[model samples]
Target: MFLHSRHLSRRVAIASATALLTGGAAAGAAWATTAAAAPAGPRTCTVSDLYVSMGRKEGAAGSLYWPIRFTNTGTTGCALRGYPGVSVLDAAQHRMGAAATRTGGAVSTVTLAPAHSASAVIRTTNGPVGGPCQATGTYLRVYPPASRTAVLVPAGWKVCSGTFRVAPVTR
Candidate 1:
């Protein structure tokens, strides 16, 4: 799926990333209990209900793994299942390469309470996987499962191949 930018400000990006890393402490207990035992949530999470952010990059097997977090910012719990639609975007807010392909993982619904989060890992190559390099990505456009709306998260990468893959969303 192609994601179109909404031209959000830098302040919004910082705030969203902050929420992913530090703002969900109080809700951890609820998140743990529900995510482990609860059934699928009553409603699916929408883009407006999530604050998306990218965690620190880790390198392995000649590829960089980015942990993309989706924190629930709404008042109620919502569900996230399967893989998120991910694509690299340039500074000009245009698609930089092919969208991510689902790699592997058990598909399970994660019910996130307000302030809690679920995550997916995106794997990108440091060297060309399929062809020569193109423009480096400045941001990622991520669509939560089952939603058309896209959330933009700041990123810096030059992915040359269509080999970019994303693991399924998990608790």
Candidate 2:
């Protein structure tokens, strides 16, 4: 009789442990599903949400390279994908040269938290490569991708090549 009681007690303990473990596992799975169902990431960056600027100037082999930067000024996180529209503008806001041609390259989405930035490479000839270059541009009009608004950055440089090439935006 004592042996029977001991065996029965052991079976009860095992059953209780199994039930607790199964309940805990089910609770954990429910929590995981709830967490995964949360909302998606923030929206794409607009021109108003970004503060545009020209980064450091670099020269190599008679070409000038500048990083066109877009900094997120808003409090929320945002994404920038693809190329930005670039054009040199005269003092009267007229287009000085043709719009910058897209420099073919791998483009990936860049996500920026508040105060973060992304950049694109801008290339131009170091000097007049062709003949009869005229009209100095006083500003660079930058249009962020998918945005209707544009930002003007002071250029204060002569565009001797009358052409600009811009690489895709990247982190």
| Top candidate (TM-score) | 2
Once superposed on the true structure, which residue ranges of model 1 sit more than 4 Å away at CA? Answer: 1-40
Candidate 1 local Cα displacement, residue 41, angstroms? 3.3
Please provide, for model 1 over 32-150, each residue's C-alpha lDDT reduced to its tens digit, 9 standing for 90 to 100.
Answer: 44345444346999998999998888988878788899999999999998899999998888997689899986899999999999999998786786666667789999999998889
lDDT of 1 at 141: 93
Report lDDT (Cα) of residue 66, candidate 2: 88
> Which residues of candidate 2, in runs, are more than 4 Å off?
1-40
lDDT of residue 116 for candidate 2:
96
Residue-wise C-alpha lDDT for candidate 2, range 1-171, written one tens digit per residue: 579657656665565566588875455544444455455567889987999999998889978888899999999999998988989899898888688899868888899999999999888788888744557678989999777789999976455566578899988
The CA root-mean-square deviation of candidate 2, after full C-alpha superposition on the true structure, stands at: 13.8
Per-residue lDDT for 144 in model 1?
90
Model 2, residue 147: displacement in angstroms? 1.2
Against the reference, the lDDT scores of all candidates come to 0.81, 0.81
* Model 1 TM-score, 2 decimals: 0.72
